[model samples]
Target: MPDIERKFKCSSVPYPPIISCIALLISMRAITWIGFIIWLVIRLIIYFIYGRKHSIVQNESKD
Candidate 1:
């Protein structure tokens, strides 16, 4: 009988794209903050609307 070993590999982005992404973030500082705030508001609204309805505590209280 022979023993065999399996290996897993992962891929990563090259340095060029990584540098471009950092540059973009630095260039769009104001827009980035605005977008972040908008995203947070939307997420909070969703959590209050649909998330709370489907929560375990709410379900338990219903019974």
Candidate 2:
């Protein structure tokens, strides 16, 4: 898999156009901005819930 990925740059090549299409779709209102807002809120909530517990900096500070 690493050899194939290196030979083709498969990991990086496919993502940019997919991201661009999604961005364009969102800008054109095909996907709805409200859904994006909700997605962001959920991401923030999950990060607040889980990120602090696993943070290396916070654990190191405690020591």
Candidate 3:
């Protein structure tokens, strides 16, 4: 059998307009204020669940 290469592609996402318009007024803003806030909330939940393990690894690498 011959070897074949597969490529990965990402599709564009539609951000909501209301909060996003504020972000567009700024430069290089991907998600507007609403997106940013939503992201933070998700990140906080992930960190609360996994932060301890990551902190241990970070400390070991630093020292």
Candidate 4:
């Protein structure tokens, strides 16, 4: 599962930061901030709900 997650993140994560950088240069409007806030909230919720439970360090310590 961790391997799969690593693979997925490798493919997906880098693009978002790049895209967000571009998006920021394109606009600093209200909607962009709103969307960023919503994205952050969702990320936090997911981290608390799932990521914290399934983290690699926690799994390794069990072994």
Model 1 root mean square deviation, Cα atoms: 5.6
lDDT of 1 at 12: 60
Query: Which pairs of residues collide in model 4?
Result: none
* CA error at residue 38 for candidate 2, angstroms: 0.7
Which candidate leads in TM-score?
Answer: 1
Model 4 global lDDT (CA atoms, 0 to 1): 0.84
The better-scoring model by TM-score among 1 and 4 is 1
Positional deviation of 9 in candidate 1, in angstroms?
12
Candidate no. 1 TM-score: 0.46
Clashing pairs in 3: none
The per-candidate count of clashes, in order, stands at 0, 0, 0, 0
Which is the better candidate, 2 or 3, if ranked by TM-score?
Answer: 2
lDDT tens digits by residue: candidate 1, 1-63: 245664753456487788998888888878778999999999999989897889998899889
lDDT of 2: 0.82
Error of model 3, residue 45, in angstroms: 0.5
Using all chains and alpha carbons, the TM-scores for the candidates as numbered come to 0.46, 0.45, 0.33, 0.40
Give the range of the ten consecutive residues with the poorest summed lDDT in model 4.
1-10
Question: Which stretches of model 2 miss by more than 4 angstroms?
Answer: 1-27
